[model samples]
Target: MADQRQHVQGTLSELGTPLARCTFVIVDLETTGSRPGEARITEIGAVKVCGGEILGEFSTLVDPGVAIPPSITLLTGITQAMVAEAPRIEAVLPGFLEFAALDRGTVLVAHNAPFDTGFLRAACGEHGYDWPAPTVVDTVTLARRLVTRDEVSNHKLGTLAGFFGVGAQPSHRALDDARATVGVLHGLFERLGSFGVDTIEEVRGLRATPTSAQRGKRHLADDVPESPGVYVFTDAKGDALYIGKSANMRKRVRSYFTAAETRGRIREMIPLVEGVTAIACGTGVEAEVRELRLIAERKPPYNRHSRNPERSVWLRLTREAFPRLSIVRAVRDDGAPVVGPFRSSREAELAREALHHALPLRQCTQRLSPKKTVPACVLAEIGKCGAPCEGHESPEDYARHGEAAREAMTGDPHRVVEALTERIAALSAELRYEEAALYRDRLAAFLRAAARSQRLSALAAIGHMVAARREETGWEICVVRHGRLAASGLMPLDSDPHAYVRALVATAETVPPGTGPTPRAHASEMECVLHWLDAPGVRLVELDHPWTCPSSGAERYRDLTDWDRASPSTTRR
Candidate 1:
């Protein structure tokens, strides 16, 4: 037991000053107004406490050198007459500063600290005194961390005082409130004991009030390392319940049981969590990709994304005698120009509508042979389509529309964007607002899909690549194979990066070339890779192909599409 206590103390010493060895000055102020520059202190009250024992007290009234408004007098019960004969802030400031002794490494305590400290700092500045800028702990923040709404109505000092049955009751005066806050602070300290928080640093770093279940399960975090990694929460049967990654594995795993983790699904999964598995990595991107891969493979109940990458739908121009646009769940090697990996079928349909609006593509969801004629649909009646199904339009003529649609998806979208924008303008001019809005949605969806497809294809076409970003600790290096993260490592600062890069490349996952824009990687995963590539200071160390996107791509239509969607008229319905 003695060894355990010594071990705990040694651990905490590295964290911060222990509460038992620290002195705290609990302060409260009655001000003429809220803003620091706009208001002056009417009264100041503080109690200095170390280990729950009051060491001293400081109280004073200050003449604001301005008339106290009736509203301020009503709220704090400090009238102009009360402070008219009191010492001015310049006179009262030094005595209070001396009594607080914050410059001697004492922690400052206050309820909603910014208000009181702001005024104090302003007064010191006005009086030509340097502000100490001591470590501040807000009791209001601590109360919210330890006490839940079930125990107290709010985090206000008065509410907490009543909840704790503190001897002093707050009455809008400075001294009474400061005394009441002392009891509230002690009560919060007792609650912190259950979470193993005894040091001032732990108190300052406390996140949220953990539920009893989460508190009981806190032991699960005992083995998690303090490093960048992926973590898995497993059930009694050893099946993964949730998967996540963080720069600090231990801290992130611990947060699952804290109030900082407020996701309803995660809270529900916590009780079932029987164990935690940690996979330490050399860099954040490596951890991220590992988490993505694990979640995709396990399809954990609490993990939402990358689990069903196969469910993504795409707009495909079918390869046939007369090709027609169709929404497909998977792409084929038939070399058809595809538009997406759209998250939902609805988005693919919207993109399809936008293309149909510009070109005379057949809306019929069937194989149309150039040799056999079929009945036309209503789209043909309205001239929205050229009725190629009836052979009224030759395949050569229909081919022009199909080629234009393909070009819009894979290359410059100017033709489709220009045609749709013109139609939107014409509709808005005629006050056919709803129809114009529908067209606007379709255009935006098309542009969004086109931009993503172009970006993904540009990267996916590359055979092999290596990139590095300068980080504080080292150079974050990643090896990419067809837009998938194959391997990643951090080259230690001041070390040889070429050798490390070679070693990482040699051990990377062997990736065979895959078909289509996203290849073997999920679109979302490729997007994450793209995000890392786009960050500042990222240098391409090696590449098999030129890393570039089409200069005439749909990216140019982004602003106009965004503006059309954000227009006030379209937002109403």
Candidate 2:
């Protein structure tokens, strides 16, 4: 048998202080049974060691206050007589807790930690002693990862101890089993060293052995800075494989090589990643904005959403004699107001239905002239529209209602919201629950669209603005123009604020004039900028135009949109 003292001392010296300096207390318990709440611990054995040197040893027998089962006595060779003169569990638990106090980087090691820890924890709870939740390391978990099934018969303590030629053998005695575990633990440490695992953090975080491809690309993260930023994983041909944001670029990027990355898509992408690039940002918000812009510009193969601006749909008020809501794929400046940049045509149509239900807006597909004479449609007959097609309603009067509908879409949504609220209440009162739900969803969609429109409109009206917030090392500054991020940088606390501001403005990115009707890319950027500006404690440094949303905006109809109350529909009636 190997000298236990020499094996531990040798391992500690070679591994250095991070692993060497750790104090490991290997523990084992012989109990009446497996259930912690009901099973009583008959014997407790522990060996506390540091750097392979045994620092202390503890062993005790405890009276369970109950008769030991014949089966358990046969398995453990412990009976009622063995613990008859011994102190009760309550008396023995205090000393054990003190011995395992989790200060000074102490770690508790067991073959299967939960089994032993559970009994100890239950004893603490029952005896009214606080459980300190010491950091636990299970050798069984380590064995599963380190030794393959082909190399070991099983993960049992005796199996591992026999495989490693441990000095002490577990024979149903607590102290002998705990000593055997110490040997198994040292052997596992030696295996971990082959994979360059040295630190306690590495051991604790070790999930699976890295693949050869992952191991080869480990150097890609060597120079990645540990800061908030956006990271792009590129393929062998330099095509962006994936783009992600993280507070710690190095840590996040490194995680892709481990078993923690269970997403099969990401796993497939990882092996193809030949390069890793990081764009460092001053603040997390800046990193988020950059991620959005980069994804929009690149439309990277792996990115699912926010990849294509052309895919966006909008709700446009047509520029005609009698304007009607139309769902279009693009935005145009035709002298008529637009509400969205909505996610889909379906969502935009829902908002349109809500507005049409509340106002007499023409729904005809044909363009009508003031002098034209045509038959009115069923919508006109049902009073859903003021028919300008047949000249039944005068163009001037129809235009007035069109203006009200436009106001509900853009600035004030209270009128439309109130009308929908009453309609929903009436439907629910008649027990037409599905119809009421349909109207409720329509109202919610309109309210959301209106709120987005109002915010985007207000942001677009601001020609340019400068916002700042104090940071630990400096000030975070951003310049926004027409709802897009123009420039963003960090100004050091020691630098002149005015001079830095001027420098930032001089080097700010030139935003191109609005190309499409929706300007979805700029709108997305604007939303990002607005979110940052709205964050608590942000200071408005400068503004070419006042940052304001319509006071009578969609927010006023917030309470009317609640669908949770049992009688929410009654409020409108």
Candidate 3:
């Protein structure tokens, strides 16, 4: 034991160069699953190390109580039977937190920090421990930076141990992985001289705070309206990051960015986020209508459903040579009637799963292996899809069934679902188990969406629509006139949404394609005076909330910058 301690001291001293004054708590975990939130840790091991010395180490096995998956048991060599008898996380957490908070402060270090820290935080929350979220250093991240391409076959603790010429204890156990991570840290220190790892304070200083955004929202100078309109999120460089809609501009605009999904990305983004501007509408209904249009115009990355994902080809679902689902850029408006006009190709594919539940439809996306010899898709055998992929069903026979599906998804959804239930009983009587299952799942999602859907049939119809989600710098406008796309324009919008959208729509005939139009153009000034003469019913909406307005209220609009180019006397409404 004394010899092992000396050897460990010698190894850790080498890391002295890269890590200046910082102390680190080396940690490891055996988790029940890969995802952070749901998974429970079965074991935890950690050690406090500083100035080339091991101050202390703690290791404990936890009774997760939940039966471990077989694969996880094989990897960790800890069976459900072994953990079944161990102490709970609550009993083990106090000792763990004690070691973690040792010596004033220490950053946690782990081979795969996310795996360890995720489990640790989760356990702390479960046990009600005061684990003030700790800063972490990933040895895995460090090894990637330090290790040469040929030296390591993989970055797992076993592979990393082999590269550093450090032998690991029984692998997969939390204590062993922790030992391996410490070895990697020592190896990196010897290889790269004097690399500085920041203390928690220094690391946290890199984070961008939400104060600026809060201040921007609460700015006394902003012109806010109670109506509906669009809002623009922009970076310091004046690049549009996101575009959103709100009905109550005062309340809805403030609700955006409730919290950053990922702190790392948001921290990097915070200092760069400069301001947000809003457009106001008279009602929530109008806001929802315009929100879809604005999304098609802007194409913001933050807004996934709104942006057109590339490589996403819409399934036309044509009655073609394949007699199955056919891929295309848009849903076919060709002679063969389309079953769906889905928002996305992915959603269209997922819709297949739900379709079987909602409607009695013959479905396929395969064009390979001739019938009789060809085996059905796994989904077909498992009763998730109808086995039409094998050419067992003809388009003429399935046409009525397909029509029911189209109604459920794109048209009269109520009638579509009601029609499918009657058909499922008939298919079951015919012993078509595969056909029944497909309709079962599809109907479930359709009903769920329908139950949640407050949509009254497309009342104020706009023409063929193509929309893009807005980003930080400028807003986007996708114009579809009479069921055909006129064009798309990206334009900077005013914080006061009522004035902004009016300016945008009134001058829609002039802005250049691709990017947003210049703010405060002379043509816009001339058009606003003549705005009511054209389309007077432009609308605004707030997202995830029930507020809206028409573009009619005078108090609903305000321009932040007062440099107004007055409308000439010749301009008449």
Give per-candidate clash totals. Answer: 0, 4, 66
Tens digits of per-residue lDDT, candidate 1, 392-472, equal 889888888888888899998888888887888888888887787888878888888888888898889988999999998
Model 2 C-alpha lDDT per residue in residues 1-573, reported as the tens digit of each score: 111233110110122236788899999999999999999999999999988889998999989888899999999899899999999999998888778666445899999999999999999899898888877889999899999999888999999999999999998889999999999999998887555566566677777777777667778887889888888989888888788787778866776675434456766677898999999987766787788778878877777666776666777788777888888876775656677667667768888898889988888888888887799899977888777888877878888887897788778888887898898888878888778877876887777767777788777777678899887878899987677777788888999999999998888877644532234245666666777888787998889888788899886776544542335344434
For candidate 3, the lDDT comes to 0.50
- Judged by lDDT against the true structure, how good is candidate 2? 0.79
Superior by TM-score: candidate 2 or candidate 3 = 2
Superposed by TM-score, candidate 3 places the C-alpha of residue 554 at a distance from the truth, in angstroms, of 35
Quote the positional error of residue 326 for candidate 3 in Å. Answer: 67
Q: Which ranking of candidates, highest lDDT first? A: 1, 2, 3
Give stretches of model 1 more than 4 Å off: 1-77, 82-171, 174-193, 196-209, 569-573
Q: Which stretches of candidate 3 lie above 4 Å from their native place?
A: 1-20, 194-573
Give the best candidate by lDDT: 1
lDDT against the true structure, per candidate, is 0.84, 0.79, 0.50
* Candidate 2 minimal-lDDT segment of 10 residues: 7-16
